[model samples]
Target chain A: MFAAQAFASLFSSPAKTSSPSLASDHPTGGQAAHHAKPLFFTTPHHLKLTYFPIRGLAEDIRLILEESGIAYESENISFHDWHEGGIKQQRAADNPFGQMPILYVNKGEFILSQSKAIIRFIARSTGLDGGDAYSAARCDQLAEGIADLRRQYATLAYDKEFAAKVGDFINKTLVNSFTTIERVYDQNKTRYLLSQDRVSYADIMLFELVDQILALGQDARSVVAKFDRIGEVYKSIAARPRIAAYLASSRRVVAINGASASVGAFKA
Target chain B: MSGDGKYHVHYFAGRGLGEIARIALSEAGVEFEDHRFESLPADLKATTKFGQVPLLVTPAGDRINQSTAILRFIGATHGLSGKTALENAEIDQVIEGVNDIRAKYRALPADAANEERIKFFSTVLPQWLGYFEAILKKTGSGFYVGSNVTIADLYVYVSFDSVINKTADAQPIDAFPLVKAHLEAIAARPRIAAWIAKRPVSQW
Candidate 1:
């Protein structure tokens, strides 16, 4: 079975983010808000990232753009607005998949969707992807491994009975997930996941995933802390100047459920 | 084929994920040891890095999983991915698009009611078919990304033949003329045609 294909539908829907209501409060109350023109067409030679305001699927992409020092326009679409008339009336006109994290490249002429696809595209162009075919494949494998772990975590995190079964989730699923990652670290024995001298996109992806898991709860954090290599990676990546600034800035959406929910889960 | 080390592909005896990589290898004229398992052997399963099949043991003795990653390796090694970053992105987009449709069908429950199945055929299937049709029209190259055949074309072709065409009571592809023609054109490639004729027939 193609697990990637089996789980692709899980990510097909637009990712939702937690944010203060923007329905009435238009922060940028100028021609920009009024016009509501397709951002892709007007923007040129700059990365245009469209996603929910919350740091869900787009968080890693945002970190990449910032770390690359690339000039990008980050549009945080309000969930309320999207449901009302935003996506159908305006956003859907340009996006083929009608999903968030759609990237506009090459002066807005080329539209790329699918978070992983977009991530790889940016990584390759920016040299965050490995130097050669083998290294690149290694990076891709690690990214896919992180994705698989996330998929397994989502099963428990998104469950309606999550609160009651949090212990089971951490013990049975979460620990195993971290162990799998730890094994990869052990095998590679490098500062980075793939043994690349510098940070690759996979390292960034792994850092984000570990950070999210730690954010779940004290139990989650304590368990994840046991993985020394993962802890090292998280610390190193978080200390990067741009990433550090982004984490400290208001741009980083506040944790929704304080360690109980997954990275993208909205507070109940 | 150029390397002295062995290239072994381990997957079940079926035309699933393994087929696309196999097609790419065949198209590139690379020699690899085809290791098909009637059912996954316990030892092999345990040894797999990701506990998954469609694992490509590179000549360098590194084990790789995930079909897309394997395809990328094959494409990069064999020069079928693309010439530039933009072209590779386009190719990735197409492969992901094809995966989206495949996922939708795979998501259907095993005990799905007749109405749900019918709904899939009538609505969902046509929607994706139309999207692929539009893609071919927009590209205007008869291939997915560029002027030449890439791994995306091979993937789209195998997916349509193995998954969409194999569905029970599947609709004909007559509506999407370009997609239909694209499938035929890929199948008629000399090496691909030879593989299709000689490769072991298995029920996916």
Candidate 2:
């Protein structure tokens, strides 16, 4: 654990250090030597992240890029613009799933799509994947659960009877959805999902989801507070200087989703 | 670890999320116990951290949920994943691409005559399939990632197989020649074909 923490710090605040061989950095190397090659991204790599004109699936990604001080621009595409011969449509044939939130890496050398893929890529490129393959696998597992939670939130938000059904969803369904997260936190006894002092992809993703839930005001806040460890993760992540600044900056995405009739935090 | 030890994979009898991991283990020629259930028993469910299926009880006795996580573990140790973070991301994007279509395809009302389903089979499904077809063309490697077969290929093959017949035309695969051929190619691999033939029969 000590070595893992030290490995994490080397990448968390990346320096222009010489590359370390995979075998030297990872004592448990060979099998995962390929997967564990950490890219020390002292400079921005994800040049542009394009998504719908809402937080939707891109907020966690935005959080990572900002916290790492990686320079990138966000391009928001409206539904109309996507269908109106815009850049999104132009890139559709190449875009994975022909969807928004595609990343333009290093000035479009590689155009990567899919939110989860982008999140992991940014986490890896910026050293947030928990330092080794095992911890990285655990981080991936927790992040998958958060993706499921986000999907549930989206499903309810887009429900035809959202106005009538949202109260029940916020009060009951979401609380149940969070049980595994709370359990993971309890079992780890860490301030963050994977580490006590370091932030991982899961922490960023959970923070993004919690931010939306908290934005729903007192009731939502109280429900989240019910999971004390989750609250700690949220506070610790939001307190990071860059993350804090990003949240306070004009670029903070206020909408939890795209144009849904009654999405809790969709600003419109 | 190089996945030298045995493992136990738990899931429903049906070939859903669990099938991918099963296919991966079989492909890697790793020995493991395959536990299937009609539904997760309460006792078994209690042991799962999330009360979910497709849990892989590891060689180390760790209970891992999330099909992706299990696949990642297998992939990393079994030479079925990419060589670098970038390569893995590229591989993962393909799976996420399949997932994106699967979610939308699942949400369509089940009525065979529904107009939305009609539009989906004719437009949406084809649209998504074309993206994959183009991916194959771009890679031109006969595999989703790298020169060798990865979990990305298996994932796309399994996911598309389950949903491609939803409305016949609604989930069309014929027009995308590369995707259609890719599916057939994957289905015909000796080990994969043996597993497919011997695996349990399920509607889904």
Candidate 3:
């Protein structure tokens, strides 16, 4: 089935110049000669990411690019750049959401102010889309869970009763979330959430959650130690070769808490 | 705020709907005009868009509305959206879910919303959390959508951290394993680590 799909994909796409048969037979004599390069090859996939100087949201796309092995230029501009230049201004004018993280592809820009949209796009290009509809939905559903977690945390983080609310949130909503996740881990026979094999973006996301919990202040470890499965998964992904290497590489990082208080502004 | 090139996001300084767009630019590595209003923007009342302040302006001076549309446009052109149709759809669905819950939270004021919020967080959220946990139960794989990272994961992590780490009246973190494990994974990312380290310090 996979082979048949691959063959179909090959034939469906325009012939490439690299194919000797097509190159020899066309001789500027047929439709093949008119359009030999693959449709995707017809245009370059250069991307320009527009956001604040901080990594408040774009990190996921960066991770996907690194994982996919696609080399795209990263144009780090400042807020001043947008005010000083009209292109950035016009780009946002075109934005329905009137936000940053507008991506310029081949000089033709497609804007997605939501962080998940951008990350998912990058993941798909990297062949990260999972096997079936259910699996894919599961991945999305997990992502939703993460979003919920962030919203809850954001509210509590800002409340004057930080200690009280944050602690309550951790004990109530967060704990329940983890327990439910633990149940999921058990259901999949202690493998991943979608299936028994193959890692997904959600897996990496889960790893991030655990790390954040552990590293959050001092008592975080104590809070996290309660969930054995979470701890186990954290150790597992942290140990993965690609992820480990990615983590080690300097390209994997940008500003984090420098704009932590800017959570309310994130459309990512 | 008076200039055509100026963009104003009216939300509180904390991470919210605007941060994703802000982060996307950082990842793609471009800068934009930004105005963070501690209080509502003084010119908000005069702005053309209906009372809200989270507005973006173009060089041509066009105004945009809705957060999802903006993110989609940014993701598509910048390669931040997923690689395939399925991945994109999945990301969309997850964002939809996030919206669903965020709407729930938005409906209520901080004090008045606590009870309803608690019920939704403890009950409704768990159901969704369970669904994700099932995905994580898959063998060997660590991600939500596919083997590689996706925006879905980032949003999820951001959302999770918002609840567990940021909120003062937020719920506990011990209840959901899928949620717990997933959070752990996202936090471990180096870029995310950098994000955490560089997060700004504010009174809120």
Better of 2 and 3 by DockQ: 2
> Model 2: residues >4 Å from true position, as ranges?
A1-31, A34-46, A77-80, A264-268, B1-4, B166-171
Whole-model Cα lDDT of every candidate shown, in order = 0.72, 0.76, 0.53
For model 1, the superposed segments whose C-alpha errors exceed 4 Å read: A1-44, A155-169, A255-268, B1-4, B112-118
Error of 2 at A171 (Å): 2.9
Error of 3 at B48 (Å): 45
Top-DockQ structure, candidate number: 2
lDDT tens digits, residues B111-144, model 3? 6356776776667666666655654553125666
- Compared with the true structure, what per-residue lDDT tens digits does model 3 show for residues A1-268? 0012221232233222343232235443221232212322223467666666654456556555555555666656565566577656576433323345555554543334456666665544443545332244445445556655655665655466666666667677778777666655665574666555466776666776665455345465676788777677677766667667777877554443223342233222
Worst 10 residues of 3 chain B by lDDT: B58-67
Across all candidates, the chain A TM-score values are 0.76, 0.83, 0.68
- A16 in model 1: Cα distance from truth in Å? 42
A208-252: candidate 1 lDDT, tens digit per residue: 888777766889888987989888888999998988988898877
Q: What's the true lDDT of residue B202 in model 1?
A: 88
